[model samples]
Target chain A: MASTMLRTSALRSTIRATPTVASKRARLAGVSFVRGKATLPDLPYDYGALEPAINGKIMELHHSKHHNTYVTSYNQAIEKLQEAQQAQDIAGQIALKPLINFHGGGHINHTLFWENLAPKNQGGGEPPSGSLSKAIDGSFGSLDAMKQKFNTALAGIQGSGWAWLVQDTQTGSISIKTYANQDPVVGQFRPILGIDAWEHAYYLQYQNRKAEYFSAVWDVVNWKAAEKRFK
Target chain B: MACNLTPLISPQALEPHISAQIMTLHHTKHHQTYITNLNAALGKLSTAVSTSDITTQVALQPAIRFNAGGHINHSLFWLNLSPPSSPDAKSSAAPQLTSAINKKWGDMETFKSAFNTQLLGIQGSGWGWLVKEEGKNDLRIMTTKDQDPVVEAGLVPVFGVDMWEHAYYLQYNNVKADYVKEIWSVINWKVAEERFLGAQKNAFGMLKASM
Candidate 1:
């Protein structure tokens, strides 16, 4: 009977997710229009820049291996999509959704992620100033409060995914969000801050201590980069 | 409501080949989400099933099926592995289960080859299973695509191996063949034997009811 029986969260988040399929289509259309030209973007700094927080080995593997794979795969997916469109291969185009969602999300999210971090001496760890600062305080009470909420979203992600701080471009209100796998947020919201929670993002350095990785990433927050987008 | 995650058999208890990190994350993060999502789907299903709103039920079928299957499969999978018994541990600890496996597949080595072949044939995310048909000594090696419950197909699952990329991706990466080849060392024959006995009794009980 001891061998016979075995056993086993209700999660809530405050952020209002208003996903628009039209905008999602718009983004996919834009990518597919470019055909096979999707190239991996360079890191804003050296691989070792976020050292003691994000390790060089992880950055190298992540960008070169992981992110590059996405870029390459996305380009291929788009090329196939174009071919399908020309042939009017409806089934083939439909079959490409999972591939597009995953790799497209990967390429798009990592592009934003690179810009979302800075070297410590530059602006990493520095909180937002000017209008974006006012907006953060208005939306989440304070900068630290926003980071606390962001951390919660990051930690609560059940699997490989990303925790994002996204702003509705129409109203400029901030929202905390999480997406599973390589699902990228597009349309209606401009991504302000993103924390990659995929194990590959930190497993080389943090192992199962994801909390430590979440804490360390705050030091490298690119508030200035985020501010430019905010303004 | 009927589905839940099984307590981990512990990470290190099943490893020298399988690492503690892989087991821990697979249990806590991956499997936990499946149960949580299954609970959420069931919460919705209670309404749909009660109302007999076939539209909502149809819309919700994939989520319910996927998550419920995830919960069921992982529950069984947890009981399927244990620490290696031998010092060198070149083999498994399943003499009794091995006899059943031998009767079914002619030998343990042959059974593994057939089972692993079924595992490799999985195109994407899925699970490989050893199941027993009701009211008979019939044992089958089968594969379910994408978190599909074996019970949904009307068979009693005795052992299962999760083949979702998350299950072994961290340790095995894209080389899933290595994972399938190595997984046999840790299968808990004891649990399989218990389930096998349980299956026979349940089958016999069904026959008696019909009579």
Candidate 2:
């Protein structure tokens, strides 16, 4: 499914690149050019793949409805920003910043989150080895200790947000961090693993017993993805 | 000072409209955490003020606003809800407020429709409110994002509907419209009536009691 999406996007890019007289005429008319649209990336595994830990129904809604809305809204915000820039509307552009930050961050975070999960059969929950393992031990004492800290951080988020296992870019030391309301992990921090704590992430499956959802998600954490980011 | 705010209605009272499980967790776990964090933030804030640590004091603003707003909002929320079966839940229980709604939105049904629309329009975590413009009987519908309490000078948050997913997701799932629809049944119009007439001073009697 992911490959199919990539192929379709590639075709669209080719079509877009074939600039003709009409395209030039539209550009001359001050029509905003379509730079690119953010598309929802296909899930690495099937919806039902995460099963008992995170249900298929929840996965389907979170991806198709919630995540897709962010992508669509983000594209709209970018389009409006271009128009605002053309019109030199400073306040309009400034007002659009929050929308862009929110939806754009939602896209970035969810893209990472989907990659950071796998079915048990696909080596999900497999303990890290080598440098990543050593770093986890060096920073957090043990893998279990890191997981506990991450869970506690996840629980502390008062509203919609994410908890991340991040490596500081300068020192390469790992730490747990949380951000509220679709704010992305950026700057000097390299996000190694992120667990979404938004109620929509688990309310359908676990309801108010979010602590259980926190504990259960570890069974599907894709350590290989985290290992790659760690290095 | 530690907060010891308790629900005016029993946790199980608002069942069906809001489940007992949801109420229990929303009150005990969610609201309690906010109070705990708010108390801690206040402690640090006092020390920061005493030492004139401006940077530390400035940094604590978000924590104070978020947690204190959470505590205030939830404290009001519990009082503004009653069992669906209770007389307090009826629109007629709030005659003056109902007349005010009629003056503003034509009638009770129209007012409710407008309120529900505002509730549904909220993106992410936030609240929808039926507010009375300060020093006047005029009412309007408004929304606040992510633990922002209605603190605009003169504006009174007569009552609010929590649009946070935690408020309804356990029972309503993704069909938030259903939650919005059912919430009207449990809305304690009696309390809203008191708020509309009595103004902001009466709104935080619970918080003042804690003081």
Model 1 segments beyond 4 Å from truth? Answer: A1-34, B1-16, B20-75, B82-158, B162-181, B184-211
Q: Tens digits of per-residue lDDT for model 1 on A1-231?
A: 121111000000101122354346547776433322566666767899999899998898888887888777876787688879878999999999888888878887887787778779767898889988998899899988988899998986644679888889788788899987777888888888888987778877876678999999999988876776674
Q: What value of lDDT does candidate 2 attain over all alpha carbons?
A: 0.85
Name every residue pair that clashes in candidate 1.
none
TM-score of every model versus the real structure: 0.63, 0.77
Off by over 4 Å in 2: A1-32, A170-173, B1-21, B32-69, B82-123, B138-142, B148-155, B207-211
- Model 1 misses residue A79 by how many Å? 3.3
**Residue B187, candidate 1: alpha-carbon lDDT:** 76
lDDT agreement with native, every candidate? 0.74, 0.85
| Error of model 1, residue B103, in angstroms | 16
- For all candidates, the clash counts are 0, 0
